[model samples]
Target: MRATFSRKAALLCSAALISATSVMAQDADIDSTNEDFALDEIVLKKSKREIQTETATSVTVVEQDEINDRQASTIAELVDSVPGVTIVNGASPQGSGINIRGFGANGTYGSDQKVLIQVDGASVGSEELYRISTQLFTDPALYKQVSVLRGLGGSFEYGSGAIGGVVLLETKDASDFTGGEVGFRFRQTLQGSTNGNGFASSSILAWQPTENFEVLGNFTYNKQSEQKDGDGNVIGNSAFELPSWAIKARGYFGQDREHSITLSHTDSQVQDRDVPYDSFGTTSDNFGNVDRDIDNSATVLTYNYDSLSSDLINLDVQYSYADQQIDQTYVPGSSPLEGGPSWPFLEPLVNSNHRYETSKFLVKNQMNFLTGGVSHDMRVGVEVSRRERLDASAAPGGTDDRLAVFVVDDIDFGNGLTITPGVRFEDQNIKGNGTYAGDYDNSAWMGGLSARYAFGSGFAVFGSAGYTESMPIIDDLGTPLFMTQSEKARNYELGFSFSNANVFSDADTLQLKATAYKTDIWDITSYSNADTVETKGLELEARYVHSTGFYTDMNANISRGEEFNAGVATDWRNSPADSLRLTLGKRFGETLDMSWEIVANAKMDRSTTPTPSFNAHNLRATYIPQEGAFKDTEFRFGIENLFDQTFTPHLSTRPAPGRTFKVSVAKTF
Candidate 1:
């Protein structure tokens, strides 16, 4: 059955690709002979705003349109499609973990999260001793843009513990709904999936009292039952119910409305029953269950001054607060024979509940300026955070206070060459109020340097090297507090980008980017300096677009990671797998867009036992009414795991979903 399904998918994809290519070629030949074509552009802010091509780091940007195109239910689904990145799935509502260049794939504490998640200039975390999963906890519809920074995170402007990388999420603005005129707008959407009988609905409202003043709000509800794997067997403990909402208010001031302020708040919660025990824990084979509830809320206030009067400087200031808590009750389940000898004796000692809470308050400023004959962009900021374990289990609730200041400078030399350098200094203290806490003060300085040279319009080369000294969080300083010193990392990377508008034809465009990097982290999970972990990898991406609206993209990555022992590496688990993704898409007229994607992975040797690889296919389509009665309505549909191959993702033990169909409808007025 699998073979037959696979062949059918292959045939359909081939036929669609050939048909679309032929039609697009003829259409472009006549209508786009003199037209200009180029790949999509991505801009990110590390220390300052810059195009991805001009930056010395690997960056991936997912725009709001792409998010809508995929109809992603979670942030993990949106990011996992990017090259060189992975967010482990399986856990409902919230994903398990996020891995960047083979980091942040282990540990329970939220502080152990290697990748930083930022939303609208504010960081997100639960700060629980058993930290909540970093990705997929919030609804994807709340954000307008998601950007991933690979390799060295550039500067300390984003706070600490970003030795792996950083993820920046930009939330939707009232301006996104309200045009330049003052009015009211509303949007409604409904989506459903077959695998888990999942359903979701969202409503958004925006009101512009004046051209320069606007308010927006969004609410969403999501629910899913048990999911079925590729073999048509139910995957236990894969059900959840979630609700999320957000509100924003912004106003423009000053003569030309160059000065602006924004205030926003977001809240989300997840409820799940029969939650499975951690698959990576000491009770790996245990069949225990828990009733879980997690909640997260954040508020941010921002002010911006563009300085229309002076070209010397522009300023942005922000203050944000975020809090999260987890509540869970373990339920008795069938005794596990493999759960050690104590499982049987403790079978009746269930129904216990635990609570954890954490919060953070941060304020920062970004200053852009030009000094002397050189252009400089800088950021200065400070942050404070606290975490507590409400229901003491092993560690008592504690408070951690920190004061941090950081500065980064992007210097332009004018001759197609630019250099970026930065440093951060922090003072941190941990106070134990509940169970275990000692008065300790820690300080450290982190710094990095990056350079990029654009020799021509479509070609650029870049390189970077950096070191980060990150202090332990409250979770890391738990119980016995086995760790005393801060964790540190040395990172380096080099890459290039190329683009051509006439790669295949005058009306066609092509772009390519490739990068390689290596990172050595000290004291990642130990106090001993002799323990070192190293990760290295290469990522490549290529895209081609025809003026007639046909496009294709290929992304691939491979790497290796391990712990070093006297210059020798052991227990290597790098590169997860050599994987490649190919996508073909075409737009029909002004109403329809269709796409097909194939993902393939090569076998990987993660341990003494190698993991097998697999291939998967997906198809999606979107339709919009251009001028008919349904002009303001849109429809979308897709099929995932077309072949229904029963395979697991590399570094993951949970089985992926089977062939599932999903659809959605939306209307705006």
Candidate 2:
């Protein structure tokens, strides 16, 4: 049994952590660089890993510093290292999307809307279109933080049907550059990559003319050509021209800044020429390749009022409208569709388009109080949203109106035990127009329980049990194979964590977290007759940071899935191959830092066709010369896929990228 899992342990022993934030943040103002932290207290700072150790669920945070270090061409590549998370459809930005815990789609096929993606308190990615991905399609430079909360244990507040998890992206604020000072500042970054012959430019203008008002404007221009796999083969439909921009403003009023309002807008466009109909898969001879014009944009407004005299009266109100549109134009004389049972009714798809516009409003409040000798942290909220699909291709076109109310309470017993229970009630009306003009009403209650106990010895145990019902959208209701009923899922998890300070020195720390979970979903619906699916997985993360600026981090994920139908069991698409990712790095007194990474994926044992495994290596380094004339400049360099091993990732139709060199430089004034 140990031999079967020796690689998991071996991978852990060969891992490294990214721990340069502390060393970089510790410098005083006099010795600071362009990206310096103008703070008084530095020693009490905490790294990303340390903050993650305090969470019970499977959560990961990718901050701006790490984002700058990666210099990835796509968002898929930006968050590749997170455990139990897969960003599929890397071949094209328009087809890119996220799959967490086997809940999302690949290429363009999953109708299950289990994963929730939010940017600046606005939900953006959600759809079911033919040969089109409903996943995220945005540049990585727009956001300052990317947070993932995996599993149903922590997804109730976000929305219903988040059986996989939730991803939250917060964009950069004006304060990031102006530091809340009454002045103007500008920053620029330029990056280039060898694999795709790509270049990216980012410019930010921040102005804070008054303490009560601040605004930020950002513009990004990115272009990348087709890339080659390790075998030096060009991956077709991989090229894109993208230009994105964002404008954000925040206004503070009232005494002590008790009230604030924010308005932000962003737009991104990706245009690809003669790409495969299935951007993530092989080109269909019948349809061949086509030109794709994809646009994703969002506008969000937020208001907050936190009482100065009372900690019990805190409130937040937010409203957002986001749109995603994809337009495909077919080339002349590309190939004609062969005669089939549905040929007579099918018209030549000279042009096809799908657009989704969502408007959402939410109000939430939090209070901290004591009741019956138990300290209670309570949160209650309401969310109302309307999503409309316009002129969809072969899919339903209509609007879905939904209202959700939720409450979550975190109770601390003061005896080293904490229990959190949350619940949500959602009511939605799906209305279809045109051919499938019908309205359906659905409502359900869902929730979960999580508890953790700390032993005061740097060790803790936690567990969660959750159940949720998934409501079918208009696409599912109007498809040929219709589904009127909601799917039900029951999930359970058990985990433990250990965190120690001053492990070898007062400045060193070590942390480990492990989790085992199982999910049984009844009434599962798919294209075929498959139903009643069950899955289980194991996840582990370990990290160690030394006072000497050396650190190591590793994570492992293994999942197995099966579906039963007519007394026969078969492999489920939700089952993903096991993977292990490790990193090792050190900080040379904040002036220079380097890290090496390894990502190993196991074969798909249940795959009908043989799926091989592969390992990819990456090295990255950054330098910032302190106390020099060029102190306002920073440089970064990286080498991806160092060995150039040709292999395809499991569940992917295309081969991964080859060895690529990347470099970037940034300056602030």
Candidate 3:
């Protein structure tokens, strides 16, 4: 009966294709849809809340629509196609950390986090090994947009220690569902996947009691069983459950609506049981199951004021608090000594727990004015944060304090050119308590310069160069010999962007971007201030869309990492392989749209270990009733891993799932 049900699901997808094309002839008669039309002129913001135009560094933006279309439940799934980004431990049930330019890639027991995660206005997790991945604990549905900055040169506005880059996530607001009017809205969604018979349910409520006041709330629950490989073998101990919730409130004051306040809170938790393993990916192959639980919670408050008369009064202030914890318990199983007598510690149940807590405050001001016929946009900001770590077992834990101030200016030459200059100063101090008492302090100065010039032929060139310094995190500090010179790096990059609205026809469009960069890191924190790292890479991205709703996208990268000791190149443990991703799909209609997509990834010659490549093909069919009781309801069905190919990703121990089906239904009232 199980086999028959699986076969019928596959046949239903094939039948959907046959029926969708027939209805497309009539559905095409509708007016042109403005969806996915923003192939150019994307806007971003810095930590100071200043607009970052095209002259700024390279960034990848993913919207909620795209996330829904791909059913990306985890951060790793959401960013797999982005250049210079790799997901380590791709098959683990407990989340995975990201590697940007080989910065957060190598570790046997513990390693410092080079890639930072900023949610709302606070950084939440710890870089220590055995800690939970920051991005994975939170539900992806809570975010409305996700942005990824490629290198250090573009990330000075945020706090230090982002040698790899920064990932900023923005949450949804009440106005998103209430349509800026006085009303109430409620939405409920149910989705499931066949990989491990996983199921999820989410509900959202929004209320706009007055023209200037609104509130929104969301709750979600997720559960899954053990997943199976292509050969129908269970990846043992890979079962989990998650519960998440959030609340947001916004208020607009002042007669001219110049002042606003927003407050939000989010909480999420995950519980799972799995086998214990170490660096080589097979340290405890014959051990028992390891039960684990992770929890993360945060709260943020923001105040904004826009002067009605002068730009000098434009201001923003925010405060936030966050806490994260991980708990693990190990239990022995039968034949625990299959390897040898070298393992005798698995006698009874062992338990451990760790926690990280942080608090932050920020204030910024922006001024736009003209000076001698040249326009200038200036911004100034200050930030302060305190972090604490806790351990119940024989591990390292401490507290740290950081303070920073920065200034930035964007000058327009009024000749299709812009110049941007920025500088920052940071002071960091570390303190240890509880039986271990010590102190360390460090300070540094960093700055960068960037420029962009647009030609008359739909092309533009941009480049940036800078020097940056970062202090060690809690885990990296607190050792007996505390030497703190701070990690420093020199970064450089060059890139170009091109866009054409009419590529082959009046309604067709094409966009392309290419970038190359080199960075050298001295006084490395992980290497105990001995070795230096040099990393270089080239990235390319292209997208084309036809009037018939057909589109193709491509992203590719070539990168390498090397360590230097006394100016001699050494084999680094975390060198990335050349990888490529290609995606092809078609949007059938506007009202009752159907999408068929194929996503594939390939790589060769991995520096750490040898591995095979993998590909996944997916199909999505969506239905919306135009005039019926279900007018506002949506239904979607899809299938993942169409070929059921058995393959493993680099640095992964288990194989990915095969031949999975998915279904979702959503209704709003």
Candidate 2 segments whose C-alpha is farther than 4 A from its true place: 1-51, 108-111, 336-350, 479-483
Q: Across residues 1-669, which tens digit of lDDT does each residue of candidate 1 receive?
A: 113223244445545654755343231111011112222221110100112454676888887667887777777777777778865553355545566777655334333556778778666764433323534578888888989887665646776767768888888887897775799999999999998998999999999999989999999998888788899987654577879999999999998998999998988898766665442332443546556677877788888887777754466667777666666666655436436786654442233333434345555555556677777776666666554545345344556677777778788765567888878888777766555556767888888888877664567787888888767655555544433578889989888877545656656656678888898887655322337887788988887777677878788988787777677767554346778988888877657889998989888876544778899999999899888889958899999899988887875546678898999999988
TM-score per prediction, in order, is 0.86, 0.91, 0.86
TM-score of 1: 0.86
Most TM-score-accurate candidate:
2
Query: In order, what lDDT does every prediction score?
Result: 0.69, 0.77, 0.69
Better of 1 and 2 by TM-score: 2
- Pairs that collide, model 1: 561-574
Give a tens-digit lDDT track for model 2, residues 1-669. 113213234333323211433343541111111111222111222332433555567788888888888887667676667777876656457566677777776644633687788889888875766556746578888888888888887788898877778888898999998888899999999999898899999999999999989999999998988889998998766678889899999999998999999999988997777766665664454555677788899999999998988878789999999998888887655546635554344333436777889999999998988988888889999999999987455666888899999999988876667889999999988888887788788899999999988764567788999999888777765563343577888889999887665656656667788988898887665435777888889988888776677878798899888888887988876677899988898877768888998989988777664478888999999998887888958899999899998987776666778898999999878
Candidate 3: segments with Cα more than 4 A from true spot:
1-55, 90-95, 105-111, 130-135, 273-282, 285-288, 332-350, 478-483, 527-530, 565-571, 592-600
RMSD of 3: 10.1
**Residue 513 in model 2: lDDT:** 86
Clashing pairs in 2: 16-552, 16-553, 16-583, 16-584, 17-551, 17-552, 17-553
Ranking by TM-score: 2, 1, 3
Give model 3's TM-score versus the native structure.
Answer: 0.86
**Candidate 3 — what's its lDDT?**
0.69
Each prediction's RMSD to truth = 9.3, 7.6, 10.1
